[model samples]
Target: MNPLIRPRRLRTTPAMRRLVAETRIHPAQLILPLFVREGLTAPAPIEAMPGVVQHSLDSLKAATADAAAAGIGGVMLFGIPSTRDAIGSAATDADGILNRATRAVAAEVGDALVVQTDLCLDEFTDHGHCGVLDARGLVDNDATLERYRDMAVAQAEAGSALLGLSGMMDGQVAAVRDALDAAGRTDTAILAYAAKYASAFYGPFREAVDSQLTGDRRTYQQDPANRIEGLREAGLDEAEGADVLMVKPAMSYLDVLADVAATAQVPVWAYQVSGEYAMIEAAARNGWIDRDRAIRESVTGILRAGAGAVLTYWALELAAEGRV
Candidate 1:
């Protein structure tokens, strides 16, 4: 029998480590989430998220073109509209910012990268909850499903390859799916935010989307304390015909992600949310960590945990660096 077992032998060089790496990142595996604001002549920077911006329509086309050239998988678009109402009437408008942005990106990229839209009302609603709040100020699930059915048709007509079902309303995936099919958009797909949590990690994203939420969304979003609940959500979405399933704030919810990934039959994805991106960027700016290595390490962990794809803010930059 051999006496010495030096695992260190494989760890001796960068080439050696690379040769045996179990998990890897690729440019085509990353999806860049982009923000498009209405009526902006120029792009505006988000202070909470360094190096990210709310793109004007022109700037959005440029960003989409850049993402296409870099061989990235896709761009997930979130719109910051100019107005909102209690019922979010603008959400179903054909010429609304989101639909306009979706059409613009589809025309710009032209299948070079997948064009996905956030199919939720939070960005459109004046109160900024995922759904319409009743007279009691509680979110109305059935009412919201009707709204999503309308929004689904709008996004599909605008050329979204996938609608991100992030609203967490009851029966959302089935609702959106039926709506799309009835509208004759049998090709439009869904990416369900199966295990989205009520986490503080979404703070930067609220600012990014111009959210008007005055209170917590704990009623609809999954509790951070519950693990089995994530699987339940996943199972429901899959049964409802979700083409993809995702876990948000992935760095903190790798366990939830892992469970969903293990049980899911479709492609599984994870989102390294805005706060997770901001934290890393902030520390890197302060020289507290090696930025390049940290980005790779963080995503590698998520990938190893069973995510086939990751939505990250660094998609473009990582692709440019040829790190994949």
Candidate 2:
């Protein structure tokens, strides 16, 4: 049978496919997620995440400089403090590891790239929860909001251009927005983790941040079973003045990402989280797949699913490859 319309014509050449690509990824649209552990003298490789590392302050600056040079969008910084507490006091201290790293990065490449910090207590809290627990040993929502408010101001003061609010607490976006506005840091922006799911896929991330968690965050993070609730959460964050909305563990939540991206008035981004990254890297190392091809295809799928940008560990590598 002869078809009048032929889709194979467009697939004939690489250039033709490139020219017709509906979802193209630019280097400037890729945000790299970085981790810096306090007091480290050198970069330490993360075992589960193979090529990724926990950088020292000096290494962090060097890495950020490299990222800026690569022309990638930005770097999202996560700090592993030398100390932890019940209330995550260091998260609000100007001299804290995260804050200090933020200041250094901004000084090094603020003019070239967006400097973002993880505005969550999980890494700083001894309890391994995103928020402080009450006397009953359960997460205290309102108390957590209070802590987030303080953390927002601190991150802004430390020169973070965007605060990645990953603590999925209720009213978090509003609380942080109000706090930032009141502090006269009106220029700082919030990237709400609007639809972060409580998935087992975050297992490698726990190791990356040295998470002290004994249990899980299923109480706060969205359940994987609910799709409509993702839209609801994204809408709430947007209504609360989120400058950007993100869906985490992106590959597993493409439906949620698409839904949010379709309706979000603000930029919608996705996180290619630690577990997702580990799966590909591990598989590739075992010769089951082409490493480079898998990396490109995975990100392309995420972008095609409707993410305006992606926070990935491969931002630098992709940017250097000159095509993604």
lDDT of each: 0.94, 0.95
Q: What is the lDDT of residue 227 in candidate 1?
A: 94
**TM-score of each candidate?**
0.98, 0.99
CA RMSD per model (angstroms) = 1.2, 0.8
> How many residue pairs clash in each candidate at the backbone level?
0, 0
Show the colliding residue pairs in model 2.
Answer: none
Alpha-carbon runs more than 4 Å astray in model 1: none
Best candidate per lDDT, number?
2
Model 2 agreement with the true structure over 71-163: per-residue lDDT tens digits = 999999999999999999999999999999999999999999999999999999999999999998899999999999999999999999999
Over all chains combined, what TM-score does candidate 2 have?
0.99
For residues 210-287, what per-residue lDDT tens digits would candidate 1 score against the true structure?
999999999999899999999999999999999999999799999999999888999999999999999999999999
Question: How far out, in Å, is residue 63 in model 2?
Answer: 0.1
Model 2: weakest 10-residue lDDT segment is 315-324
